[model samples]
Target chain A: MATITTTRDGVPRAASQPTRGRPDRGFGTIGGYIGRTVLALFFAFPIIFMFASSLKPDNQIFADLSSLRAFLPVGDISMDNYKAVFDTVPAWRFLANSIGVSLLTVVLGVLVNSLAAFALSRMRWRGRGFVLAAIIATLVVPFETFALPLLWWVNKLPWLVMQNGQPMWTLGWLDSYQVQIIPFIANAFSIYLYYSYFSTIPKELDEAARIDGASWFRIYRSIIMPLAGPATATVAILTFLPAWNQFLWPLMAVQSENLRPVMVGVQYFFQLDVAWGPMMAYASLITIPVLALFLSFQRAFIGSIASSGVKG
Target chain B: MSRFMIERRGTAVLAGVATAALALSACGVASTSSGGSAGELTLWTHNAGNPAELGVINQIVADYNASQSKYTVKLQAFPQESYNDAVVAAATAKKLPCVLDADAPTVPNWAYAGYLTPLDLPQDLVSKQLKSTLGNYQGKLYSIGMYDAALGLFARKSALEAAGVRIATVDNPWTAQEFADALAKIKADGKYQYAFDLGTGDSGTEWWTYGYSPFLQSFGGDLIDRNGYKTAGGVLNGDAALKWASWFQGLVKNGYTPAKSSTDAFADFVNGKSAMVWSGIWHSGNLSKLGADGIVMPPPDFGNGPKIGGGSWQWAVSSTCGEKAAAMDYITFSLNKKYLAEMAEKQNVIPATEEAAAMVDGWQPGGAKRFFLDESAKYAMIRPPTPGYPFLTTTFAKAAQDIIAGGDPKTILDQAVSDIDADLKANNHYGF
Candidate 1:
């Protein structure tokens, strides 16, 4: 309450935050809980509808909106839809592929970007601001604007050099996991995160670590790395979820079904002449992982926002 | 100064995060190798998921490759909605395959833009087989028809039995008035709803335009002049479209049909929720899946002429390559009656030819013969092949949407004619 009125210009306003011993009011708090529950339910309705529809027999899903006998009809609630997922499409294999790409993206992308982040953030000698500004400036440009140029650049990689002056490049990245995972790892959002987090860590940590028998790289690997736990987790979840659910990028990049991800498989569920039970079943499957990820990481994700909202 | 300090801090963290992301992205990918066996030609299509269907197509592609020692084709796929856009982009970048499964309306646009090569089908061939399917802009055969998708009605046998209604055959299908009474009877019977899936789409647009528009033309309701040049002073602002709109509006208001949300006839009817549903031949797969014992007849003739919503899938080759002979060979094989049989049977699509239609044998649903042969024929219609058709659908669908959602039909139709008039002028497709 004090923070709302008195902390306009920052007079060490941490004291203005409400004390944690007890809440000052209980009625508004109950009302607030009720309001939040209602709002949460509103957001949860479509997902609930999808899950409910998944449990139904194909026909009654769309046609029998009023049949009250079953949330899941006994015979109807059988694993036919899930069986369709496994048999009709290689649902699990695609899911495994998705996991592989996501893991690689998280591990490799976080490490490289963090190293670069450390360089740009802590060990600044010259042109640091200019380089950082240029990176930030790229944020305004749309990814699609760079699609053709990036495609050409990927083709022009030295290791994947053109042979014998024939048409094909040796990389053959199309429809490969490399194509799917590599292009997305270096996102503007991740760079922005590392830069900001790097700036906040006192330059003294870098100086002290560097002065005490450690080289610049060693200082970065030890001190700068451990302090970045929350921020790294912050970037990992934000980056990975979108990469997991990504449809268009993989679509534009990967050209074969064997190479396509689970998202495309889920989308094809709707293209059929009838999209009732099967569509819902597949939709529920895709959404479940996303939902579980959010629920498990709810604390860390929320904590990052709360901390960043104040300091950022 | 504090603001400056915060900005500096924000920029550093952002850059660090971005660079870390870039590093992570450089991870290894298990590369895929095409161990080359010579003579493969690449293909791009949207039908990658259906293995059985693709297998049939691949055999045809194989046959084509076998026919010529110099060529072998490879297949690639994108999502169906993405199919045309991807093809268009490929054509621009010279990345398109020798042939593609393309939309009919686009064949003309593509052909006009150096995107497609014309087929060499003779007038006699077209006269006997495809006069109805070909677009006649410049009077040359540009593409061949693959299949015709005609609209029809689907009713549940047990559901209709409970409602105590009977439809004998195509000659005696229900008139509009009788159709209404029967639906009311079905509703009053309480075991099943009257009808579901009163689509506010092409069917509704056709209902007001051609189904009810014929009534206007018969009773002298004119939308515009023959060239479709003037419409603001036209008779469409009068009663023809209105009458059709009111009939649909009545179907809901009188409880003879389900509400917009409750109109999934295939699901509801097969599951025994409603007596009847209306859809096209494309939905035969769904009805068959529910088992033959439960499904029933197409609706007896509703009050309409020999018109229903029917359109064809056309096969044309891209002018972007010299693979026309191979492309045409692939097209002919894919559309050959034998190849289309399983697709028609398993996927619930109507065959474009008699031989393909007769080949539907696997798991025929009970009481579904009427769907394959009869009631759908009585009211089938296709969109006019005017270049302005996309604009026309948007205009008509908007009006129909407004009417179904409770807008005044006369007002909407009035605005619609004006809108369509402008579109036709813009696209230069002004035939009445």
Candidate 2:
């Protein structure tokens, strides 16, 4: 429904209904546009500099620093840095490993965290709150405070491996992808987010599903999970970011070059006479996946960040 | 009800399977074999990303493996930035490779911690090496590098001449007064943004100690009292140290140098932002790009003599290694004159031996960078050789940083001396 109005010129105007969550297009809207454009440029500047510097030679990268030329594709520009980056590190291998590790972490993290959250939020089990509180308490302790102890435990932990056509037990999870993925799968923050989201879904739906002879797990799978799409996406993203940008843990845990993530590959160019252009090119290459993910899920990503209180 | 029973039974079966799998894995863990077995030796290097150094080490490994079948030497290269942490972590896990490289200043600390075993190289090979290249801990040689690095005052002869400053030479480095007069003259000339660049922007802890501690020593103050390796009381905060600190702070106060230099000090020098730069020999290439006007001179004398920090990364055998003989064999094989020259050429550092210097092109007599070799041989003083050197470096770096940022020199140095003494006392004088 719309309201009709007559202007001074005697033409009828149809005033559209104000939609919920939409701000009126007033003078403040113009200010918002300007503010947004400035913010956009502020964030885009670093990426632009990286890409522009990636195209230029090392000396020119420094030479153009004093002027607007730094962010522009001016001067002698080429893909020489790309070639050098390819020569220096196993870019494809590192990227593939990172993608594999990050994807597995996200999928597993979502499943594990959601299940834990469902148990805590939906179930009426005893000591469930205590368990939740304990998990949440871990959020205060940084990973670095326990990294060494975790390393020792991981080294001592056992894993099943197929060796010489036989299932064999292996001691030390070092130099393997499982070590990188498994340790990060059970994140506390992801569990908390899932639990918070799960609590919003009506328990009557669960009651009705149970009355229809649906098991708790079945209800979780067929109803609640599908309803928690935004939370799942948020957890997947949150899980993907840290797992993708992992440096210290992977550096210490994985010894084989084939298991290294792209973040660690950044250090390959940081030698005596660091190849600045190549390093920038490599950074630009690795940043593509994250940018693509953000662009595809921009709305949900923004909402998640806003709700989760994550600044950047 | 039947379906619920079926699902519950299935869950039990799945849990059983998982338990069995974990048990099998546990059995395998129990039977894990000892490390360094099967005639294989693992050697770790801080050369990952550095293709030049990695290539040199790889060639040495290839030669060593081919020359003998007694043991196969496998090389694992880690990036230099994270290399020390990795080594420390590996040591904690008792998973250190048979052979590894340590930065020279940290060698004594590693040796004291039992992470490295003493080297037993032949007397002649040891004698041929530069004194700084040898990692001596409690009079035992534990590690040795293929090359060493020297720091110098990089200048443009034309810039100095225009400012009416005498060109400093190896035999006649600028004295304290002469250096000050030259900086003042250059600053008064107003031809450059600043008279000197002391590489202030690179605040890496090692750079602070490596670049500035030598100045402290030249002022007759050491990071620690070398006689007992017990204290820095008289040495670091003494009258000499205060003089060094005042002189260091005066440069920034008088505007002879910037309080914070550009990140790439050498780049600033080449851009003519500064007339001179206190930098390492690695910038020789960029300096050479200035043509014949480029000059590298020894650090200015601050009463005692001009000085530069000595030592670089050197190879050692881990104490936990079961293949010490094989590790030593590889280390010996890797230290050939040819490899040394190749490493120095690739890294643009000074070759550790006279023979290797002759073998390298730019290291020859009267070559462009021959002065660095001469300075390293003459003026380079190895950092305190006690296991406490790590704590000493960090403490000194903090104090010097504070002094440069306008903290009282006496108070800052006194605090540094207190911290160093406390750490040494905590570690029983670091096995002095």
The model with the greatest DockQ is 2
Could you give candidate 1's per-residue lDDT for residues A1-312 as a string of tens digits? Answer: 222221221112234456448665788899989999999988977777777777776665654455444343434566577766665566777788888888788888888788878788777579988887888888799877887666556544423323354323344455568877887888667777877766666676666666676777787788777666666777778878877886766666566677777887865554435455776787788777777877876766665555455222
Candidate 2, residues A1-312, lDDT tens digits: the string is 335443332223345634249797989999999999999999999999999999998778877888999999999999999999988899999999999999999999999999999999999989998999999999999999988998999989877778777777778887799999999999889888888877756676788899999998999999888777767777888889999999999888877788899998998886656678999999999999998987876776666555445433
Per-candidate total of colliding backbone pairs: 52, 0
**Isolated chain B TM-score per model:** 0.73, 0.95
Q: Which stretches of candidate 1 lie over 4 Å from their true place?
A: A1-56, A60-75, A111-179, A210-219, A284-298, A310-312, B1-39, B62-68, B77-82, B121-137, B156-168, B184-196, B200-239, B285-306, B355-379, B414-432
- lDDT value, residue B60 of candidate 1: 64
- What lDDT score is found at residue A179 in candidate 2? 90
For B227-265, candidate 1 gives per-residue lDDT tens digits of: 443343465565545666677667777776654634354
Overall local distance difference test of candidate 2: 0.87
Give one digit per residue, the lDDT tens place, for model 2 in B1-432: 697999999999999999977777465333543235568888899989878779888988998899999998878888888888888888877888888999999999999998999998878888999999999988899999999988999998988999888888888998998998999888999999889989898878999999999999999999999898888999999999999999999999999888888667787788788999999887887887799988988998998989999999899999988878778888888889999999989878899899999998878988867898999998999999998887888999999999999999999999999998999999999777
The top-ranked prediction according to TM-score is 2
Off by over 4 Å in 2: A1-21, A305-312, B2-36
